[model samples]
Target: MTDRPDVLVVGAGPAGLTTALQACAHGASVRIVERRREPFRPSRAMIVHPRTLESLRPLGVVERLLRRGDPSPSARLHLGRRVVSTTLADVALRDTAFPHLTLLRQADVEQVLAEALEERGVPVERGVAAVGLAQDRAEATVTLRRDDGGAEPVSCGAVAGCDGQDSTVRRATGIDWRGRAYREEVVLADLDLDSDLDAGVLHVAAGRDGLVFLFALGEGAPWRLLATRPSRGGDAPFGQPGQPVPRPELRELLDVAGFDVAVGRVAWSARVRLQHRLAAAFRHGRVFLVGDAAHTHSPAAAQGMNTGILDAVNLGWKLPFAAHADEPDTMLDSYERERRPVARQVLALTHLVFFAEAAGHPAPAFLRGTVAPLLAPVVPSLTRPTLLAPVVRLLSQGWVRYRGSALSSERWAGGPGPRAGDRLPDETVTCDGMRTRLHRLTARPGVHVLLARDAEEVGASVVEDCPVSVHRLTSRPGRRMVAVRPDGHVGFRGTAVADLTAWLRLVGARARSADTATQPADTATQPADTATQAADTAET
Candidate 1:
């Protein structure tokens, strides 16, 4: 019914909405199309990991998410009659300001995000679905069909497919879905129970029948459920709510698990299998895919939504550059390279979860009984509250830093630099004596100015000609003068003003000039062998 926008998002879930918000925040126009008439009625995703909460900092949603969710301090695994392993969430991520996991319904979180998007002036368009997509070198033409059978075409500079598992965009682009599917069927229900279940722990029980996972939803509420079928699938469990429950089925599960129930109401129930899949590439020309469309893994670690939200955070900054800025085409490719490896690692973790009950493997049993519990005491020493933490930082904050493509040449130019796979910390800086978080300062899609004590060594003569801004590093300057990218990375390093100018010009190329044939590399030469070099390499 209307013309195209700067970008077209094919889903309105967390990933899609977050991508739209991030892109628009950087001044790019966007439109979102969703097949669903409305957001899901009840909450689905119940766990938001600490890493995800940290990622939400830049988006300004963590405080809100924490308010609406319950903090899960720990998790315990039971083997038959014994508590085999227990990992403290707080201790596991001890080095972070947000060290504890939050348990909130996906529905609630999605609703908050949707409302936030609208508040920021970008609303989700319900009752429309992407039926087809056509892309050229410059843009993606997305075709959407309305609920009433009307059709409209949108031509966007870029497209992000966050349309869940059965994504039409992924199929429309002919991208291969490469991953395994979980055969297990899980039955979930939200209920007001009668027992005194602790709100701080996620309890799991492994039995001959199947496994059951229980956690507190919030004040006076709890989520009780069982893996209806074997993780790999064989037979469905007893007590199918919509069907029938043997007299002993419900009572036995509750009695053993200590579910203090008093004839409560069942909010909703469903049977679904887990899936692990990823697109061959996140970007196909001008059409890019994110969240479930790009990667799907088992829900064991409860990382599906977390990873999806993170996908939004990752691509959120990149899409605007690819769609509106004069950035290089090679920069877009970095999305696939950086995120794919992460998805693969996430899948591997989910796979490790499957081994918890390997029938013939005694090693798994031993690990379940020993190594896991030991992790509790040692978790703290391994972590630190650094800027840009790692995925492994979940074990401890020390794993966080700006080490990969996430860094900018400015930071890599020998000033203070952020390591890849690390968390970006929001330090308070006084601009005109107005204090604000570093997160807010770098929000714009361009180079960041980080001035440090060592920056003077790089020599202002080399960077003075740069187009980016400069800030001097003072006491406790996170690092020396580092120029960060629009995606919250260091692009150039050193206090030298000339080097800053050159790096900015090198990275500020337009989308139209992204092709090698159009814009050749500048004489500035790439940042070599460091985080800045990697980030520049990511862009090239």
Candidate 2:
């Protein structure tokens, strides 16, 4: 690295790549580093929810992923040979353009994001790992260690710890990683199966040990198998990493689970170690954690990479703005405010979801075998597409509300539509003389101000040292106005001009009376509302 960049991302996985891509998209100089010389091309995480796709749209990676990923797929739940199926289409949300669930390998996601970053002239330095970190009031310095015994110091305005479970950046912060690893090991393999099973359906069967999962979602392989290897000394000889997982051993587990599908070829196989962990603090001084560096959970809910990507999204928009603020520390604290709680909630949510599938083989022998057969007919209904709608919605994360956040302010806060701290769903609108979705207006970086056609007269007064894009609503009629944050959440919503200005000012937004903005807004004629506005918003 030469001159200091705005951000230094220390991992090239989904989280690190997304952090670099998004920070670059928002006009920040970002340098990303990866310890591994060769990319982890394995199909580790094979699921991408719709909300994650919506969040990545601004970075121009979602469409590429959709082109190469499977959009609609059915899942088959096998309980003692009685199979019940469900399709993602049945649980699709009508409001979002990307409603259906998508299946894409984690490797593909990293590739698309890395390519996008390369297009923006941000190169990912491979074979370079951040071994040491030190930060003061000015900037953060990181020690980079290469594979060939080369070491150098790289400086950056801030360091994003996209590094995984063993994060050196996290260690530098002295934040305790509070988590535990599962006793049972998981064997991950991409297998070619010889069976009549639908190629587009995901298969999972309950066994005396744990759930046996077979996925047919990858672009190349037709099936990827995830099965639990009972604690050491079990009949299944799926040993520790680097130990060979024989095809007969895999067959032995499948036979006990009643899956008669023949394993044709073991294209790729690895013994996976499962762990659950979350960082004590997501931010420490100039060092911030993202992805597995911040939190790691079981892949049962497909939340591992998606949650990391969400972590990156929440931190990406704020890191770029921190480079310009006078009070960078105070400016960055809100990132934890808005996101830390969400991570905590996810940690708890995924913990339960992970065990719901009996992962790690924790269930008793009777429940795994005898009880499953007895309840086969009734238990399968739990996976019915209609009933899974709420589960799907929860997994989509579109319903996540940040109403308690300081960035969210409500005036008498009662309304039928979205309030401050709520997600801003896409709506039809025209831009540049062409009809487009509302979310498209944010293809560029900065805060987006959505104003009713009638409110244009008052919208100009809303200015910020930070780049702000203001759009006048012409497709509909109303006096309501809303401010959409860079992370796609509503910061403020109201109809009064004075109230909106007060919010802008509260959020460190500058007021304009002349060619340039005045720091202390001339509030001589401005009338402030008691409830419509309160607290601060994003800083420049």
CA lDDT of each prediction against the hidden true structure: 0.58, 0.71
Find the candidate with the highest lDDT and give its number: 2
Per-residue lDDT of 126-229 in model 1, one digit per residue for the tens? 99999988888877888889999999878887888999888899999899998775645455656556655565677776544445677765322355554434
lDDT of candidate 2 over 1-540, digit per residue (tens): 347888999999999999888787766788899998987557678889977976776566666787778777777878786877667754636545565778788888988888888887887889998888898978899999999989988888889998887788899899998988766667777778888888778888887677788877543466778887554433332122334478888888778778878988787676766677878898888889998888877676788899889878878877776655544565588777777788787888877866655554446555766687777677556766667667877987777877877667575256556799888887666433445556555544556666766664444443233555566666656777787776778878887767766665444443333222211111210122111111010000
TM per prediction? 0.75, 0.85
For model 1, the superposed segments whose C-alpha errors exceed 4 Å read 72-89, 92-96, 199-201, 208-210, 218-222, 226-228, 231-264, 323-327, 357-392, 395-447, 453-471, 476-479, 486-488, 506-540
- In Å, residue 528's CA in model 2 sits off its true spot by 40
- Candidate 2 error regions (>4 Å): 217-222, 233-242, 325-327, 359-386, 428-436, 456-466, 496-540
Each prediction's total of clashing residue pairs, residues at least 3 apart in sequence or on different chains, is 64, 1
